[model samples]
Target: MATGTVEHVKFRNRDMYWDIAADLHFPPGFDESKTYPAIVVAHPIGSCKEQTSGNVYAPALAEAGNVVIAFDASFQGASGGEPRFLEDPAQRVQDFSRVVDYLVTLPYVDADRIGVLGICGGGGYTLAAAKTEKRFKVVASVTGANFGRLQREMAGQNGGVIQALSTIGQQRTAEARGEQSAVNGFLPETAEAAKQTGDIDIIEAFEYYRTDRGQAEHGCVLFEAAHGTAVLGWDAFYLAEELLDQPLLIVIGDKDKQGAFGAYRDGHEIYERAASADKTLLEIDGASHYDLYDRPNGAGEALKTIVPFFNDKL
Candidate 1:
Protein backbone atom coordinates (compact mmCIF):
# COMPACT_ATOMS: atom_id res chain seq x y z
CA MET A 1 0.00 0.00 0.00
CA ALA A 2 2.89 2.30 -0.57
CA THR A 3 2.57 5.27 -2.93
CA GLY A 4 6.22 6.23 -2.93
CA THR A 5 9.74 5.09 -3.65
CA VAL A 6 12.15 4.30 -0.84
CA GLU A 7 15.90 4.64 -1.17
CA HIS A 8 18.55 3.35 1.20
CA VAL A 9 21.00 6.10 2.07
CA LYS A 10 23.81 6.91 4.45
CA PHE A 11 24.93 10.19 5.95
CA ARG A 12 27.68 11.30 8.28
CA ASN A 13 27.01 12.22 11.89
CA ARG A 14 29.75 14.82 11.94
CA ASP A 15 30.06 15.19 15.68
CA MET A 16 30.26 11.47 16.39
CA TYR A 17 32.42 10.49 13.42
CA TRP A 18 29.92 7.86 12.35
CA ASP A 19 27.76 7.15 9.33
CA ILE A 20 24.01 7.01 9.93
CA ALA A 21 21.97 4.50 7.98
CA ALA A 22 18.67 5.92 6.74
CA ASP A 23 15.73 5.23 4.48
CA LEU A 24 14.30 8.04 2.42
CA HIS A 25 10.70 7.81 1.31
CA PHE A 26 9.90 10.00 -1.62
CA PRO A 27 6.33 10.83 -2.53
CA PRO A 28 4.60 9.35 -5.55
CA GLY A 29 5.83 10.86 -8.78
CA PHE A 30 8.74 12.46 -6.99
CA ASP A 31 10.61 14.95 -9.14
CA GLU A 32 14.14 15.91 -8.27
CA SER A 33 13.76 19.13 -10.23
CA LYS A 34 11.07 20.25 -7.83
CA THR A 35 11.54 20.75 -4.10
CA TYR A 36 9.43 19.14 -1.34
CA PRO A 37 9.04 19.52 2.36
CA ALA A 38 10.93 16.92 4.37
CA ILE A 39 10.30 15.18 7.67
CA VAL A 40 12.81 13.33 9.85
CA VAL A 41 11.41 10.42 11.85
CA ALA A 42 13.27 9.30 14.98
CA HIS A 43 12.86 5.77 16.29
CA PRO A 44 12.37 4.62 19.89
CA ILE A 45 14.98 3.66 22.45
CA GLY A 46 16.78 0.39 21.63
CA SER A 47 15.09 0.51 18.20
CA CYS A 48 16.22 1.14 14.65
CA LYS A 49 14.93 2.74 11.47
CA GLU A 50 13.14 -0.44 10.35
CA GLN A 51 10.63 -0.43 13.19
CA THR A 52 7.87 2.14 13.54
CA SER A 53 9.83 5.09 12.25
CA GLY A 54 10.54 3.66 8.81
CA ASN A 55 7.98 0.86 8.60
CA VAL A 56 4.96 2.93 9.65
CA TYR A 57 5.32 6.70 9.85
CA ALA A 58 7.81 7.36 7.07
CA PRO A 59 5.84 5.73 4.27
CA ALA A 60 2.55 7.10 5.57
CA LEU A 61 3.92 10.62 5.58
CA ALA A 62 5.43 10.15 2.16
CA GLU A 63 2.11 8.97 0.78
CA ALA A 64 0.65 12.15 2.19
CA GLY A 65 2.90 14.06 -0.26
CA ASN A 66 6.04 14.72 1.73
CA VAL A 67 9.58 13.40 1.84
CA VAL A 68 10.48 11.48 5.00
CA ILE A 69 13.73 10.05 6.32
CA ALA A 70 14.00 7.47 9.07
CA PHE A 71 17.53 6.87 10.25
CA ASP A 72 19.29 4.71 12.83
CA ALA A 73 20.88 6.50 15.75
CA SER A 74 24.64 6.92 15.64
CA PHE A 75 25.37 3.97 17.92
CA GLN A 76 22.64 1.58 16.81
CA GLY A 77 21.26 -0.29 13.83
CA ALA A 78 23.36 0.04 10.66
CA SER A 79 24.88 3.33 11.82
CA GLY A 80 28.50 3.51 12.88
CA GLY A 81 29.47 4.10 16.51
CA GLU A 82 31.71 2.59 19.18
CA PRO A 83 30.63 0.86 22.41
CA ARG A 84 27.62 -0.39 20.52
CA PHE A 85 24.12 0.32 21.82
CA LEU A 86 25.22 3.32 23.84
CA GLU A 87 22.09 5.49 24.18
CA ASP A 88 23.51 8.90 24.85
CA PRO A 89 20.76 11.52 25.11
CA ALA A 90 22.95 14.33 23.82
CA GLN A 91 23.89 12.38 20.67
CA ARG A 92 20.29 11.30 20.15
CA VAL A 93 19.16 14.91 20.20
CA GLN A 94 21.95 15.95 17.88
CA ASP A 95 21.02 13.22 15.39
CA PHE A 96 17.85 15.12 14.46
CA SER A 97 19.78 18.25 13.56
CA ARG A 98 22.40 16.18 11.81
CA VAL A 99 19.61 14.72 9.70
CA VAL A 100 18.44 18.23 8.96
CA ASP A 101 21.94 19.08 7.85
CA TYR A 102 21.79 16.25 5.36
CA LEU A 103 18.33 17.21 4.14
CA VAL A 104 19.31 20.80 3.48
CA THR A 105 22.14 19.71 1.26
CA LEU A 106 19.73 17.91 -1.04
CA PRO A 107 18.56 20.08 -3.93
CA TYR A 108 15.12 18.52 -3.83
CA VAL A 109 14.51 19.30 -0.17
CA ASP A 110 13.22 22.70 0.92
CA ALA A 111 15.49 23.79 3.74
CA ASP A 112 12.84 26.07 5.24
CA ARG A 113 10.06 23.49 5.19
CA ILE A 114 11.72 20.68 7.14
CA GLY A 115 10.01 19.19 10.19
CA VAL A 116 10.48 16.27 12.61
CA LEU A 117 8.33 13.46 13.99
CA GLY A 118 9.49 11.13 16.74
CA ILE A 119 8.02 8.04 18.35
CA CYS A 120 8.51 7.05 22.02
CA GLY A 121 11.95 8.06 23.27
CA GLY A 122 12.62 9.61 19.90
CA GLY A 123 9.70 11.93 20.58
CA GLY A 124 11.34 13.21 23.72
CA TYR A 125 14.57 13.91 21.82
CA THR A 126 12.69 15.60 18.96
CA LEU A 127 11.15 18.10 21.33
CA ALA A 128 14.49 18.73 22.99
CA ALA A 129 16.21 19.03 19.63
CA ALA A 130 13.67 21.42 18.16
CA LYS A 131 14.10 23.74 21.15
CA THR A 132 17.43 25.10 19.90
CA GLU A 133 17.77 23.55 16.43
CA LYS A 134 15.47 25.95 14.60
CA ARG A 135 15.80 24.17 11.24
CA PHE A 136 12.84 22.02 12.21
CA LYS A 137 9.91 24.42 11.67
CA VAL A 138 7.35 21.90 12.94
CA VAL A 139 7.57 19.15 15.52
CA ALA A 140 5.34 16.19 16.48
CA SER A 141 5.58 13.19 18.79
CA VAL A 142 3.63 9.95 19.18
CA THR A 143 3.67 8.28 22.57
CA GLY A 144 6.57 10.53 23.53
CA ALA A 145 8.55 9.46 26.60
CA ASN A 146 10.95 11.47 28.75
CA PHE A 147 13.77 8.89 29.08
CA GLY A 148 15.40 10.57 32.05
CA ARG A 149 12.19 10.45 34.04
CA LEU A 150 11.51 6.89 32.87
CA GLN A 151 14.99 5.74 33.93
CA ARG A 152 14.91 7.54 37.26
CA GLU A 153 11.49 6.13 38.09
CA MET A 154 12.50 2.65 37.01
CA ALA A 155 15.65 2.86 39.12
CA GLY A 156 13.57 3.99 42.10
CA GLN A 157 11.25 1.03 41.66
CA ASN A 158 13.99 -1.56 41.20
CA GLY A 159 16.29 -0.11 43.85
CA GLY A 160 16.93 3.28 45.38
CA VAL A 161 18.46 5.91 43.04
CA ILE A 162 21.55 5.88 45.25
CA GLN A 163 21.94 2.14 44.78
CA ALA A 164 21.36 2.37 41.02
CA LEU A 165 23.96 5.11 40.73
CA SER A 166 26.38 3.15 42.85
CA THR A 167 26.01 0.12 40.60
CA ILE A 168 26.50 2.23 37.47
CA GLY A 169 29.51 3.99 39.01
CA GLN A 170 31.09 0.68 39.93
CA GLN A 171 30.50 -0.69 36.44
CA ARG A 172 32.03 2.41 34.86
CA THR A 173 35.10 2.15 37.04
CA ALA A 174 35.46 -1.51 36.24
CA GLU A 175 35.13 -0.90 32.50
CA ALA A 176 37.73 1.88 32.71
CA ARG A 177 40.07 -0.57 34.44
CA GLY A 178 40.13 -2.89 31.37
CA GLU A 179 37.06 -4.88 32.37
CA GLN A 180 34.33 -5.72 29.87
CA SER A 181 31.47 -3.20 29.96
CA ALA A 182 28.14 -4.58 31.14
CA VAL A 183 25.05 -4.41 28.95
CA ASN A 184 21.37 -4.12 29.88
CA GLY A 185 18.46 -5.74 28.12
CA PHE A 186 15.42 -3.63 27.43
CA LEU A 187 12.89 -6.47 27.61
CA PRO A 188 12.64 -10.13 28.40
CA GLU A 189 13.90 -12.69 25.92
CA THR A 190 10.45 -13.68 24.76
CA ALA A 191 6.82 -12.59 24.75
CA GLU A 192 5.81 -15.35 27.16
CA ALA A 193 8.48 -14.27 29.59
CA ALA A 194 7.40 -10.65 29.24
CA LYS A 195 3.78 -11.55 29.91
CA GLN A 196 4.77 -13.37 33.10
CA THR A 197 6.04 -10.08 34.51
CA GLY A 198 2.44 -8.76 34.48
CA ASP A 199 3.55 -5.44 33.01
CA ILE A 200 1.35 -4.48 30.06
CA ASP A 201 3.99 -2.19 28.57
CA ILE A 202 6.69 -4.86 28.56
CA ILE A 203 4.29 -7.47 27.23
CA GLU A 204 3.26 -5.34 24.28
CA ALA A 205 6.80 -4.11 23.67
CA PHE A 206 8.00 -7.69 23.39
CA GLU A 207 5.16 -8.47 21.02
CA TYR A 208 6.41 -5.65 18.80
CA TYR A 209 10.21 -5.59 18.99
CA ARG A 210 11.06 -9.20 19.90
CA THR A 211 8.65 -10.96 17.55
CA ASP A 212 7.94 -10.94 13.81
CA ARG A 213 5.25 -8.33 14.40
CA GLY A 214 7.92 -5.62 14.08
CA GLN A 215 11.28 -7.25 14.61
CA ALA A 216 14.43 -6.46 12.64
CA GLU A 217 17.90 -7.79 13.21
CA HIS A 218 19.25 -4.32 13.84
CA GLY A 219 16.50 -3.48 16.32
CA CYS A 220 18.20 -5.24 19.21
CA VAL A 221 16.89 -4.50 22.70
CA LEU A 222 20.17 -3.87 24.49
CA PHE A 223 22.22 -0.94 25.74
CA GLU A 224 25.57 -0.40 27.44
CA ALA A 225 25.22 -0.27 31.24
CA ALA A 226 27.90 2.39 31.49
CA HIS A 227 25.72 4.77 29.45
CA GLY A 228 23.09 4.83 32.21
CA THR A 229 24.63 7.91 33.79
CA ALA A 230 24.09 9.96 30.64
CA VAL A 231 20.49 8.82 30.34
CA LEU A 232 19.88 9.48 34.03
CA GLY A 233 21.18 13.03 33.89
CA TRP A 234 19.45 14.01 30.64
CA ASP A 235 16.04 15.69 30.60
CA ALA A 236 14.16 15.81 27.27
CA PHE A 237 11.94 18.71 28.25
CA TYR A 238 14.58 20.70 30.04
CA LEU A 239 13.66 24.40 29.65
CA ALA A 240 10.96 23.68 27.08
CA GLU A 241 8.73 26.41 28.51
CA GLU A 242 11.43 28.90 27.66
CA LEU A 243 12.93 27.81 24.30
CA LEU A 244 10.59 25.38 22.49
CA ASP A 245 8.92 27.86 20.15
CA GLN A 246 8.31 25.72 17.08
CA PRO A 247 4.77 24.63 16.21
CA LEU A 248 4.20 21.43 18.17
CA LEU A 249 1.81 18.50 18.13
CA ILE A 250 1.83 15.78 20.79
CA VAL A 251 -0.18 12.55 20.45
CA ILE A 252 -0.59 9.93 23.16
CA GLY A 253 -2.86 6.97 23.75
CA ASP A 254 -5.57 7.53 26.31
CA LYS A 255 -5.30 3.89 27.32
CA ASP A 256 -1.53 4.05 28.01
CA LYS A 257 -0.80 2.14 31.20
CA GLN A 258 1.35 4.57 33.12
CA GLY A 259 3.93 2.57 35.10
CA ALA A 260 7.68 2.64 34.42
CA PHE A 261 7.11 4.42 31.08
CA GLY A 262 5.06 7.62 31.41
CA ALA A 263 4.52 8.82 27.82
CA TYR A 264 0.99 9.75 28.80
CA ARG A 265 2.19 12.17 31.47
CA ASP A 266 5.14 13.31 29.35
CA GLY A 267 2.88 14.22 26.42
CA HIS A 268 0.63 16.37 28.56
CA GLU A 269 3.50 17.99 30.41
CA ILE A 270 5.25 19.12 27.20
CA TYR A 271 1.97 20.38 25.74
CA GLU A 272 1.41 22.43 28.86
CA ARG A 273 4.97 23.69 29.10
CA ALA A 274 5.86 24.40 25.44
CA ALA A 275 5.92 28.12 24.68
CA SER A 276 4.88 27.68 21.03
CA ALA A 277 2.04 29.90 19.94
CA ASP A 278 0.66 26.97 17.99
CA LYS A 279 0.55 23.74 19.98
CA THR A 280 -1.85 20.80 20.25
CA LEU A 281 -2.14 17.85 22.63
CA LEU A 282 -4.10 14.95 21.13
CA GLU A 283 -5.21 11.97 23.21
CA ILE A 284 -6.34 8.98 21.17
CA ASP A 285 -8.92 7.03 23.09
CA GLY A 286 -8.85 3.22 23.09
CA ALA A 287 -5.17 3.00 22.20
CA SER A 288 -2.23 1.88 24.30
CA HIS A 289 1.38 3.12 24.09
CA TYR A 290 2.56 0.31 21.83
CA ASP A 291 -0.66 0.49 19.80
CA LEU A 292 0.51 3.75 18.23
CA TYR A 293 3.68 2.09 17.05
CA ASP A 294 2.24 -0.05 14.24
CA ARG A 295 -1.39 -0.97 14.86
CA PRO A 296 -3.89 0.16 12.25
CA ASN A 297 -6.33 1.61 14.77
CA GLY A 298 -3.52 3.48 16.51
CA ALA A 299 -1.07 4.70 13.86
CA GLY A 300 -3.82 4.89 11.24
CA GLU A 301 -5.92 7.15 13.43
CA ALA A 302 -2.89 9.27 14.28
CA LEU A 303 -2.05 9.94 10.63
CA LYS A 304 -5.44 11.60 10.26
CA THR A 305 -4.12 14.50 12.34
CA ILE A 306 -0.40 14.17 11.54
CA VAL A 307 -0.67 14.48 7.75
CA PRO A 308 -2.70 17.65 7.94
CA PHE A 309 -0.50 19.19 10.62
CA PHE A 310 2.60 18.83 8.46
CA ASN A 311 0.72 19.99 5.39
CA ASP A 312 -0.36 23.16 7.14
CA LYS A 313 2.83 23.90 9.02
CA LEU A 314 5.59 22.83 6.66
Candidate 2:
Protein backbone atom coordinates (compact mmCIF):
# COMPACT_ATOMS: atom_id res chain seq x y z
CA MET A 1 0.00 0.00 0.00
CA ALA A 2 1.08 3.59 -0.58
CA THR A 3 2.31 5.38 2.52
CA GLY A 4 1.68 8.93 1.26
CA THR A 5 -0.51 11.08 -0.94
CA VAL A 6 0.10 10.82 -4.69
CA GLU A 7 -0.76 13.70 -7.00
CA HIS A 8 -1.02 13.10 -10.72
CA VAL A 9 0.76 15.93 -12.52
CA LYS A 10 1.65 17.29 -15.94
CA PHE A 11 4.73 19.33 -16.74
CA ARG A 12 6.82 20.28 -19.79
CA ASN A 13 10.07 19.67 -21.61
CA ARG A 14 11.36 21.39 -24.77
CA ASP A 15 10.56 18.49 -27.12
CA MET A 16 7.76 18.49 -29.68
CA TYR A 17 5.42 17.16 -26.99
CA TRP A 18 5.91 19.54 -24.07
CA ASP A 19 3.54 17.98 -21.57
CA ILE A 20 5.20 15.41 -19.31
CA ALA A 21 2.93 13.35 -17.07
CA ALA A 22 4.15 12.34 -13.63
CA ASP A 23 3.27 11.18 -10.11
CA LEU A 24 4.38 13.28 -7.17
CA HIS A 25 4.77 11.28 -3.97
CA PHE A 26 4.18 13.56 -1.01
CA PRO A 27 5.73 12.79 2.34
CA PRO A 28 3.63 10.99 4.91
CA GLY A 29 1.98 13.54 7.19
CA PHE A 30 3.44 16.26 5.01
CA ASP A 31 3.52 19.77 6.39
CA GLU A 32 3.02 22.42 3.77
CA SER A 33 4.81 25.09 5.79
CA LYS A 34 7.91 23.13 6.65
CA THR A 35 10.83 22.76 4.29
CA TYR A 36 12.07 19.27 3.35
CA PRO A 37 14.69 17.72 1.15
CA ALA A 38 13.59 16.46 -2.29
CA ILE A 39 14.64 13.70 -4.64
CA VAL A 40 13.84 13.03 -8.30
CA VAL A 41 13.41 9.32 -9.02
CA ALA A 42 13.60 8.02 -12.59
CA HIS A 43 12.38 4.73 -14.07
CA PRO A 44 14.43 2.44 -16.27
CA ILE A 45 14.64 2.64 -20.08
CA GLY A 46 11.51 1.41 -21.89
CA SER A 47 9.61 1.65 -18.58
CA CYS A 48 6.95 3.91 -17.13
CA LYS A 49 6.72 5.52 -13.72
CA GLU A 50 4.53 2.70 -12.37
CA GLN A 51 7.15 0.03 -12.89
CA THR A 52 9.41 -1.09 -10.04
CA SER A 53 11.43 2.10 -9.63
CA GLY A 54 8.63 4.64 -10.07
CA ASN A 55 6.08 2.47 -8.24
CA VAL A 56 8.08 1.40 -5.16
CA TYR A 57 10.95 3.85 -4.74
CA ALA A 58 8.88 7.01 -4.33
CA PRO A 59 6.75 5.82 -1.41
CA ALA A 60 9.73 4.37 0.45
CA LEU A 61 11.69 7.57 -0.04
CA ALA A 62 8.74 9.82 0.76
CA GLU A 63 8.07 7.93 3.98
CA ALA A 64 11.63 8.82 4.95
CA GLY A 65 10.63 12.54 5.07
CA ASN A 66 11.63 13.67 1.57
CA VAL A 67 9.34 14.59 -1.30
CA VAL A 68 9.79 12.27 -4.29
CA ILE A 69 8.52 12.50 -7.86
CA ALA A 70 8.51 9.90 -10.65
CA PHE A 71 7.60 10.72 -14.22
CA ASP A 72 7.27 8.86 -17.50
CA ALA A 73 9.87 9.55 -20.14
CA SER A 74 8.63 11.70 -23.00
CA PHE A 75 7.17 9.57 -25.81
CA GLN A 76 6.84 6.63 -23.42
CA GLY A 77 4.45 5.66 -20.69
CA ALA A 78 2.05 8.56 -19.84
CA SER A 79 4.30 11.37 -21.07
CA GLY A 80 3.29 13.28 -24.19
CA GLY A 81 5.58 13.04 -27.18
CA GLU A 82 5.70 11.71 -30.73
CA PRO A 83 7.40 8.50 -31.79
CA ARG A 84 5.98 6.50 -28.91
CA PHE A 85 8.48 4.24 -27.14
CA LEU A 86 11.35 6.14 -28.73
CA GLU A 87 14.53 5.49 -26.71
CA ASP A 88 16.54 8.70 -26.95
CA PRO A 89 19.09 8.93 -24.16
CA ALA A 90 19.89 12.61 -24.65
CA GLN A 91 16.29 13.79 -24.24
CA ARG A 92 15.64 11.26 -21.47
CA VAL A 93 18.50 12.70 -19.45
CA GLN A 94 17.02 16.18 -19.78
CA ASP A 95 13.73 14.96 -18.31
CA PHE A 96 15.36 14.85 -14.89
CA SER A 97 16.39 18.50 -15.22
CA ARG A 98 12.85 19.55 -16.04
CA VAL A 99 11.62 17.58 -13.03
CA VAL A 100 14.12 19.47 -10.91
CA ASP A 101 12.81 22.75 -12.27
CA TYR A 102 9.35 21.76 -11.05
CA LEU A 103 10.52 20.50 -7.68
CA VAL A 104 12.21 23.79 -6.90
CA THR A 105 8.86 25.50 -7.17
CA LEU A 106 7.16 23.59 -4.35
CA PRO A 107 6.94 25.79 -1.27
CA TYR A 108 7.90 23.01 1.13
CA VAL A 109 10.86 21.64 -0.80
CA ASP A 110 14.45 22.70 -0.04
CA ALA A 111 15.78 23.31 -3.50
CA ASP A 112 19.40 23.41 -2.38
CA ARG A 113 19.25 19.99 -0.76
CA ILE A 114 17.78 18.18 -3.74
CA GLY A 115 19.15 14.78 -4.80
CA VAL A 116 18.51 12.21 -7.53
CA LEU A 117 17.97 8.45 -7.67
CA GLY A 118 17.37 6.19 -10.66
CA ILE A 119 16.99 2.50 -11.41
CA CYS A 120 18.47 0.64 -14.43
CA GLY A 121 18.45 2.78 -17.57
CA GLY A 122 17.07 5.63 -15.56
CA GLY A 123 20.19 5.27 -13.46
CA GLY A 124 22.33 5.74 -16.52
CA TYR A 125 20.28 8.76 -17.63
CA THR A 126 20.36 10.19 -14.11
CA LEU A 127 24.13 10.12 -14.23
CA ALA A 128 24.04 11.90 -17.57
CA ALA A 129 21.80 14.58 -16.12
CA ALA A 130 24.06 15.04 -13.11
CA LYS A 131 27.04 15.58 -15.35
CA THR A 132 25.65 18.86 -16.69
CA GLU A 133 22.69 19.70 -14.41
CA LYS A 134 24.29 20.61 -11.11
CA ARG A 135 20.94 21.22 -9.42
CA PHE A 136 21.17 17.66 -8.18
CA LYS A 137 23.65 17.89 -5.30
CA VAL A 138 23.82 14.14 -4.66
CA VAL A 139 23.34 11.16 -6.96
CA ALA A 140 22.59 7.46 -6.47
CA SER A 141 21.92 4.67 -8.96
CA VAL A 142 20.67 1.10 -8.56
CA THR A 143 21.32 -1.52 -11.24
CA GLY A 144 22.51 1.07 -13.77
CA ALA A 145 21.62 -0.04 -17.30
CA ASN A 146 24.31 0.41 -19.91
CA PHE A 147 21.98 0.06 -22.88
CA GLY A 148 24.53 1.78 -25.05
CA ARG A 149 26.78 -1.27 -24.86
CA LEU A 150 24.56 -2.80 -27.47
CA GLN A 151 24.81 0.47 -29.35
CA ARG A 152 28.60 0.22 -29.33
CA GLU A 153 28.55 -3.43 -30.33
CA MET A 154 26.23 -2.73 -33.23
CA ALA A 155 28.66 -0.09 -34.47
CA GLY A 156 31.32 -2.84 -34.74
CA GLN A 157 33.36 -1.40 -31.87
CA ASN A 158 32.96 -4.58 -29.79
CA GLY A 159 33.92 -6.77 -32.79
CA GLY A 160 32.12 -9.68 -31.11
CA VAL A 161 28.78 -8.16 -32.14
CA ILE A 162 29.52 -9.01 -35.76
CA GLN A 163 27.47 -7.65 -38.64
CA ALA A 164 25.00 -5.89 -36.32
CA LEU A 165 25.47 -2.77 -38.43
CA SER A 166 24.26 -4.51 -41.55
CA THR A 167 21.27 -5.99 -39.71
CA ILE A 168 20.41 -2.60 -38.25
CA GLY A 169 20.89 -0.96 -41.63
CA GLN A 170 18.29 -3.25 -43.15
CA GLN A 171 15.85 -2.51 -40.33
CA ARG A 172 16.58 1.22 -40.56
CA THR A 173 15.51 1.33 -44.20
CA ALA A 174 12.28 -0.44 -43.38
CA GLU A 175 11.71 2.05 -40.54
CA ALA A 176 12.56 5.10 -42.68
CA ARG A 177 9.96 4.20 -45.29
CA GLY A 178 7.43 4.11 -42.40
CA GLU A 179 7.37 0.35 -42.10
CA GLN A 180 6.42 0.43 -38.40
CA SER A 181 5.54 -3.26 -38.31
CA ALA A 182 8.96 -4.40 -39.36
CA VAL A 183 10.65 -2.85 -36.29
CA ASN A 184 8.12 -2.41 -33.51
CA GLY A 185 8.52 -5.24 -30.99
CA PHE A 186 11.12 -4.48 -28.32
CA LEU A 187 10.82 -7.63 -26.17
CA PRO A 188 9.70 -11.22 -26.43
CA GLU A 189 5.92 -11.37 -26.58
CA THR A 190 5.77 -14.11 -23.94
CA ALA A 191 7.81 -15.70 -21.17
CA GLU A 192 8.12 -19.05 -22.98
CA ALA A 193 9.44 -17.30 -26.08
CA ALA A 194 11.86 -15.27 -23.99
CA LYS A 195 13.16 -18.44 -22.43
CA GLN A 196 13.65 -19.93 -25.90
CA THR A 197 15.96 -17.03 -26.89
CA GLY A 198 18.77 -18.63 -24.85
CA ASP A 199 19.46 -15.22 -23.35
CA ILE A 200 19.50 -14.92 -19.55
CA ASP A 201 18.65 -11.21 -19.61
CA ILE A 202 15.58 -11.75 -21.78
CA ILE A 203 14.56 -14.60 -19.50
CA GLU A 204 14.86 -12.37 -16.43
CA ALA A 205 13.01 -9.56 -18.20
CA PHE A 206 10.28 -12.07 -18.90
CA GLU A 207 10.22 -12.98 -15.22
CA TYR A 208 9.22 -9.38 -14.48
CA TYR A 209 7.55 -7.72 -17.48
CA ARG A 210 5.68 -10.79 -18.79
CA THR A 211 4.36 -12.21 -15.49
CA ASP A 212 2.28 -11.19 -12.51
CA ARG A 213 5.44 -10.69 -10.54
CA GLY A 214 6.15 -7.10 -11.70
CA GLN A 215 4.25 -6.53 -14.90
CA ALA A 216 2.70 -3.15 -15.80
CA GLU A 217 0.89 -2.28 -19.02
CA HIS A 218 3.31 0.52 -19.85
CA GLY A 219 6.34 -1.63 -19.07
CA CYS A 220 5.79 -3.36 -22.36
CA VAL A 221 7.44 -0.59 -24.40
CA LEU A 222 7.97 -1.02 -28.16
CA PHE A 223 10.33 1.03 -30.30
CA GLU A 224 11.39 1.73 -33.88
CA ALA A 225 14.23 -0.31 -35.37
CA ALA A 226 15.85 3.05 -36.15
CA HIS A 227 16.25 3.47 -32.38
CA GLY A 228 19.41 1.35 -32.51
CA THR A 229 21.01 3.83 -34.91
CA ALA A 230 20.95 6.65 -32.34
CA VAL A 231 22.14 4.32 -29.59
CA LEU A 232 25.12 3.22 -31.66
CA GLY A 233 26.74 6.64 -31.35
CA TRP A 234 25.95 7.34 -27.69
CA ASP A 235 28.09 6.20 -24.78
CA ALA A 236 26.63 6.31 -21.28
CA PHE A 237 30.07 6.08 -19.69
CA TYR A 238 31.78 8.70 -21.83
CA LEU A 239 33.59 11.25 -19.62
CA ALA A 240 31.39 10.02 -16.78
CA GLU A 241 33.84 10.55 -13.89
CA GLU A 242 35.15 13.86 -15.18
CA LEU A 243 31.74 15.25 -16.12
CA LEU A 244 30.04 14.05 -12.91
CA ASP A 245 31.19 16.07 -9.94
CA GLN A 246 28.38 15.24 -7.54
CA PRO A 247 28.81 12.71 -4.73
CA LEU A 248 27.67 9.41 -6.23
CA LEU A 249 26.36 6.12 -4.90
CA ILE A 250 25.87 3.00 -7.05
CA VAL A 251 24.41 -0.34 -5.91
CA ILE A 252 24.05 -3.64 -7.77
CA GLY A 253 23.91 -7.37 -7.17
CA ASP A 254 27.08 -9.43 -7.08
CA LYS A 255 25.37 -12.14 -9.08
CA ASP A 256 24.00 -9.94 -11.90
CA LYS A 257 24.00 -12.04 -15.06
CA GLN A 258 26.70 -11.28 -17.64
CA GLY A 259 25.06 -11.64 -21.01
CA ALA A 260 26.41 -10.33 -24.32
CA PHE A 261 23.91 -7.51 -23.73
CA GLY A 262 21.70 -6.65 -20.74
CA ALA A 263 21.65 -5.14 -17.24
CA TYR A 264 24.88 -6.94 -16.34
CA ARG A 265 26.90 -3.70 -16.61
CA ASP A 266 28.97 -3.14 -13.46
CA GLY A 267 28.10 -0.45 -10.91
CA HIS A 268 31.67 -0.56 -9.66
CA GLU A 269 32.83 0.76 -13.02
CA ILE A 270 30.73 3.91 -12.61
CA TYR A 271 31.77 4.27 -8.98
CA GLU A 272 35.41 3.96 -9.94
CA ARG A 273 35.06 6.30 -12.91
CA ALA A 274 33.12 8.96 -10.98
CA ALA A 275 35.10 12.13 -10.28
CA SER A 276 33.42 12.58 -6.91
CA ALA A 277 35.70 12.33 -3.91
CA ASP A 278 32.77 10.97 -1.88
CA LYS A 279 31.50 7.97 -3.82
CA THR A 280 30.40 4.54 -2.62
CA LEU A 281 29.50 1.23 -4.27
CA LEU A 282 27.22 -1.28 -2.56
CA GLU A 283 26.90 -4.90 -3.68
CA ILE A 284 24.08 -7.17 -2.59
CA ASP A 285 25.16 -10.76 -2.20
CA GLY A 286 23.46 -13.21 -4.58
CA ALA A 287 21.43 -10.54 -6.32
CA SER A 288 21.13 -10.20 -10.12
CA HIS A 289 20.49 -7.17 -12.33
CA TYR A 290 16.81 -8.07 -12.45
CA ASP A 291 16.82 -8.91 -8.74
CA LEU A 292 17.57 -5.25 -8.01
CA TYR A 293 14.27 -4.45 -9.71
CA ASP A 294 12.47 -6.56 -7.06
CA ARG A 295 12.19 -10.12 -5.74
CA PRO A 296 11.09 -9.49 -2.14
CA ASN A 297 14.72 -9.69 -1.05
CA GLY A 298 15.87 -7.28 -3.80
CA ALA A 299 13.91 -4.02 -3.52
CA GLY A 300 13.58 -4.36 0.25
CA GLU A 301 17.27 -5.00 0.77
CA ALA A 302 18.20 -2.16 -1.61
CA LEU A 303 16.21 0.44 0.32
CA LYS A 304 17.94 -0.43 3.58
CA THR A 305 21.11 0.95 2.08
CA ILE A 306 19.54 3.58 -0.21
CA VAL A 307 17.59 5.43 2.52
CA PRO A 308 20.71 6.02 4.55
CA PHE A 309 22.69 7.09 1.54
CA PHE A 310 20.19 9.88 0.89
CA ASN A 311 19.88 10.83 4.55
CA ASP A 312 23.62 11.10 5.11
CA LYS A 313 24.54 12.64 1.79
CA LEU A 314 21.56 14.76 0.93
Q: Residue 19 of candidate 1: its Cα lDDT?
A: 91
Off by over 4 Å in 1: 157-159, 257-259
Which stretches of candidate 2 lie above 4 Å from their native place?
Answer: 13-16, 154-183, 260-264
RMSD of 2: 2.6
Specify the poorest-scoring 10-residue window by lDDT in model 1: 156-165
lDDT of 1 by residue, 95-139 (tens): 888889889999999999999999999999899999999999999
CA displacement after TM-score superposition, residue 55 of candidate 1 (Å): 0.7
Please count the clashing residue pairs in each candidate, in the order shown: 0, 0
lDDT of each: 0.90, 0.79
lDDT of 2 at 163: 61
lDDT of 2 by residue, 86-180 (tens): 78887787788888888888898999999999998888888878998899999988888766775565355555344665677887788678876
Query: What TM-score would every model get versus the actual structure?
Result: 0.96, 0.90
lDDT of 1 at 305: 98
